[model samples]
Target chain A: MMHALILPLLFPLFAGAALLLGHRLPLPAKRGFSLLATLALVPVALWLLLLAGDGQLRLYAMGDWQPPFGIVLLLDRLSALLLLLNAVLASFAMLYACRGDDERGPNFHALFQFQLLGINGAFLTGDLFNLFVFFEILLISSYTLLLHGQGPARVRSGIHYVVLNLLGSALFLVGVSLLYGLLGTLNMADLAVRVAEMDAGSAPLVAAAGYLLLIVFGLKAAILPLHFWLPRAYAAATAPVAALFAIMTKVGLYAILRVFTLIYGSEAGPLANMVSDWLWPLALVTLAVGVFGALASRGLQTTIGHLVVVSVGTLLAGLALGSQAGLAAALYYLLHTTLVSGGLFLLADLIARQRGALGALLVSAPALRQPLLLGLVFFAGAISVVGLPPFSGFFGKLMLLQAVPPGPDALLFWPVLLVGGLGMLIALSRTGSLIFWRAEGEPVAERADGLRLLAAVGLLLGSVLLVLLARPIIAYLQATAAQLLDLQPYLAIIRGGEA
Target chain B: MEAVLAVTLGVMVTCGVYLILRARVFPVVVGLTLISYAVNLFIFSMGRLATGAPAVIGKSASHVDPLPQALVLTAIVIGFAMTAFVVVLALRGLGELKTDHVDGQEPRE
Candidate 1:
């Protein structure tokens, strides 16, 4: 069963390779194979989640070689939870893609599988360099996926996306090499231990390297200053791809949580909690800016893109609190936001498809074919996104708010979060009325695709399910956060593997 | 030797940054290529700038660290692929948008 740790990576790798090789196969066959491979991940991820729930750290050393020498995949509660999240998101995105989106471009299924391979690999690997490799894998796939249905808008955004990430990749290597130069290892657990015990002479270089890694991750996570590229790129991407990218930002947040908590965590002298102070202000500003962007945006997808930034800000605030409660809250919020935002992207696409020439712009247009059903889903998504009651978003926000120890930080967080929610409420309401009510023409005759509706609704239902399953899910996340904060089991890998 | 390497890397990075800031796609591509070169050199030197030291162990008492060599190889391959993709993307953008300007149109004079 320990081999299950590598299954997440292998399933997608093999599926993607086969899809690429079998390109000449009929479309139905390709979709079946891709769908089967993706759906298989859900069970594997769930089993891994169950295995990790036992609180034991499982290490799968490649080729029977020991850690700190061979690359290893470490599975604990956090990684397992993220793996499941990626699986669930990818499944629906794959489902959505199967509904004719795949035909818009060549190799959609293959590129998607490869993207999953990258994401799962990133979440699973315990080595820094391996994480970088996985980032490249996912990113290259994404670069192609973003341009699937080639257009002027996509290519324009793609240029910015490609150039920025290429720079980010260079910086990632610089940070990794600097750390390797100083510590003589790339395994994250070994790096954690060595960083803790390093002499003062090397501390500055290590700190520099750590900050460089932060910049790279921040670029990926789309933190405020580095976030300019996200809205354009995401909005320009095809719907299913945009929906899948909802988890992509979280990958950066996950790296921040993993690397900072394990390697440069409280146990490290002089470098303890290095990112906390910076994350606090940046998260707040990101929230504020995201709200303004959402309110000001003219397109539905771009508005949702800004809302994604808002969610990132909210999650960053939870992480900035640097508490067990905060981390657990962030993890829970992470699940809600990723699903709901993804649903919104798909829903927007569906609405745009029916609107004909208006096409998701915020102006008044013809009513959608199924106004009542689509309106209901959009309303539910909007309320949930704005952190209103009766959905998972409210609870996620409430938990994060409750986790904040009443202090100066609380003073800053409460107003920004509440005001940001209010702004989103206004933006969404205005968007809803214009698109749903203020129609200038007759409703389009063509109906929404049944499969596309199912894909979107299924994801939106994930949020409702989160509310219903809040207790068990929150408990699991709490345990996951606890495991993350307690780094002893992780550090034990390098030592135990040597024996 | 260290100073010379440092100076060369610094100049490459400076030029790369400058080129990357240009409004045109071609210079930006060149800039990215140059930066990747600088980064590769930087990673290579991180293993401590050994001359004639075997990367493989058992060939000498003190072989160079083999890890950064492996890392640089991966970086080079990835960078090369990315450069190629960006070039094609730039050409596509040029054809579709009818402008070499990154913003898809030239700024007004």
Candidate 2:
């Protein structure tokens, strides 16, 4: 049964390695291998999700070693949820990229698999140090992927992106070592136990370590002061890669959510709710900046970039609410944001191509082919993005706004959720009308890539599906949030037979 | 010995930060390399200052923790790979953009 846990990590590794070994193979073979590998992950993730659906937590110990001594991969509702989300997005990205995006680079298929491996490993690992290792894996793969087409813009952004993450990785090692030095264990469950019994004298140092780790997570999650690297990098990346990169930020959010609740929640005295205090103000600011940047930016790709930042801001703010209601709402919001954002990136690419010289700018340059159908596609994503009713974003925003209790945070969270969302709605309308509503010049006769448009539509359908499934999904997320608040089972599974 | 090592690591990181904050790409890369070295040593120090002892432990023997040593070794290899990647990325950016400043600005003559 535990083999299910290891399979997600290993399958991708082997798939990537296989692709690498068959470098001399034709495109169809490489593409087939990559697609098969990604498609296989969905079922595995679903199986794991089913196993963990009823709050089951499974721990797989590598080399038969016990916790605190050897690496362990954990599967719970949260990891399972994220793994499924990742697989779904990877499948879409693969389908979209299959239409020649992969041909831009020889090693695209291999790197794609490796990126999945890294993402899955990051989601699954229960040890703090292991998280750092997988982070490096993902970062390295992303570094190459962002430079996939090898353009100057990508290279510039890649340089900044790599440098920033490298610094973050450095801090990660420092924090991990500090925590290990203090607690004598790198296993998160063990650290939770040790942290509970921590001496008063060492509390400050432990808090500092927690703060350092949060800073690292913040950088990855694009919390302000550490977010400059993201917009440009996402904007500079090729569309398909940018679409895939949408899920990458959520990995950081997952880490933050995991580490905060597990290692420092009520289990660890004094440090409980440590980062949440600071997260509230920081996240609110991040949300504001993201929305404002969106309204101010004219380019469609840049708008998508800032829109991502907005999602991060809103999700992080919900998380900082530090209530079960808030977390469940955030999780719900996170789901649609990923789907809608990824769809929009692909949509933006198609629009840019259709507009020819204008390239996704919010100006009337030429009429796009299939303007009405594509206009509806943009409307689908736009309404969801702007948090209008009957869409996933509306459901998520409503839940989030209603979830915050009547208190100090509600004061801030309410206004930001309302006004920031309003900002998005206005920005979307302006951009939509500018490009789609008015046709001021001759239509650019770029041949429509039917497959790409269909893929973008498929992404839009996913957002609609989220709305249709909102009740059941939100119910599941509420349970997942409750499970996160309950760390006892996770600890017991890691401690094994003694429990 | 611990004090000496701590100070050395601190100095390396300080110098690395100063270099990283510079406008040039080359300095930033060098800074990243230096910072990585400090980080590697920091991870090694988690096992405590390894005195004159081989990294082998008998059933009850008092030996230094090899875990962090192994972790540092991994970090070193990754750091090297990252440094190489960044240097190449910087060089490519410079070649294409006609500038070597980290933000791609042409330096004043």
Candidate 3:
């Protein structure tokens, strides 16, 4: 049990350290080592997913210390799903990196593994301060990775990304400190128990802590007002990095859902509805702003960057509904968006490579050498992104709409989602023609590398696989959502006094 | 001790925010360091302000809870690392763009 519990963290940490040591090796050797390690995590993650899929929360107390006294890694269905998601993205991103991006800078593979370690640790840790530590680990590594294959544009955006996240980290620390001062416990399960036991008088302090946490997480997740840094930073990152980042934003959302639901959830007086009330309005505006930004974006990657913002908005809006139905929809949408957005980022990179000087700019380029193949792939990617039928995106939106109960807020949500898709359709069409259809001169692009094409196509297939396996997948997600909302099992098993 | 520490933290944070909002990169770095200092103190204060409390496990009637101290120590190390990384990044930015402006430079006419 301890082996399975600690394996996820140890695997990446050791691999990353080894990669750092072997930095003097040839590029191919380095890439191969990193690739094998990342791929190996998939099965480990899957086995754990199956183990936890039964809805039991497996708590691994580190150093054999009991709860509230030591750090712990808690595995539940939701954590398993996210670990699997991270593994899938990490594998594909590794494949994409091999096409040329890995050689863009030194120690790319090491930093990538470190980033994954931080992400997986953040997902699994049961201590709030430990989460803070993991968040820093991820952010520090991201700072370096963001600056990889350094360019003036990358550096320019990297500065803003670093400063904003530093501020967010400070806020996170402050929030955690506030909670500790008030409650004297840092273990999440213990905090939940204490919160439930608190009287009405302490509600205001919890609310302060809750709002501070919301602000920090809101910044990380790029909620509307705090979202100014994402487009520039994401657009400037290398393709594989950007693709993996599709899950990075989800980390913030995951933290929000996990903490808010488990600890400060409605079981805690006065803290029950704090985040939801503001979340709906903010999310609606986020969706609107994201769509408009996408429409205004001049480059293909920037447009995809804004599309990421749109997906975050969509997921949060569903979460704001605060029903089991809404959570189920959000979970499904998370899976859908991560894959499609990841594929689109890789697709944009492939398109840029083949398009020459036009370089993913929204303008006429000479005809691509392999138009039919690339055209077909891009069309599929665009359709999936806009949530057309027969793709996971379509089903995701359908579920969200179904989950919304008949209420006046439905008027606001329905229009934004529908209109946002419309805006997305127009943007997609315009960009599609600008690159693939407006061919006029000689065929300027060299044929793309076979491996890169295979990776991109495989991602699109992964999305399709979601469609094919919709039955079991949605069932799994619904179960995951159900487990997430029920705080009792998590509370009982890990509480300081209960056991 | 409590009121004095609170006022000090408030002053540090206010000044830090001001420096962080500056246009140049260096002051922003300093601002970040300042804010981190304030946050470090805030975390330390969670253990309460204790006088004549044993850092050891000696049988002092009210030993200052040493957990937050250990946490703040770790946080300080992490904070220093962050400051160092940003400083190098800011220097590189200045060298590359030939400007210290955070936005790199004005749009070329």
Q: Give one digit per residue, the lDDT tens place, for model 2 in A91-200.
A: 88888898889988789989989999989999999999899989999999999999998877788788889889999999999999999888888998888888888998
TM-score of chain B of each: 0.96, 0.91, 0.92
Q: Pairs clashing in candidate 1?
A: none
Task: Report the alpha-carbon TM-score of model 2 versus the true structure.
Answer: 0.97
Tens digits of lDDT, candidate 1, A1-499 = 2688999999999999999999999999999999999999999999999999999999998997878899999999999998999999899999999989999999999999999999999999999999999999999999999999998999989989999999999999999999999999999999998999999999999999999999999999999899999999999999999999999999999999989998899878899989899999999999999999999999999999999999999999999888999999999999999999999999999989988887999888887889999999999999999999999999999999999999998998999999999999999999999999988778875998899999999999999999999999999999988888888888787777666
Q: Please tell me which predicted candidate would have the highest TM-score against the true structure.
A: 1
Can you give the TM-score per candidate against the true fold? 0.99, 0.97, 0.98
True contacts kept of each: 0.84, 0.73, 0.71
The runs of at least 3 residues in candidate 1 whose Cα sits more than 4 Å from the true structure, single-residue gaps closed, are none
Quality class of the docking in candidate 3, CAPRI style: high
Tell me the TM-score for chain B of model 1. 0.96
Between candidates 1 and 2, which one is better according to TM-score? 1
- Model 1 is docked with a DockQ of 0.88
Which runs in model 3 stand beyond 4 Å of their true positions?
A: A496-499, B107-109
The CA-based lDDT of model 3 is what?
Answer: 0.89
2 against 3, candidate with superior DockQ: 3
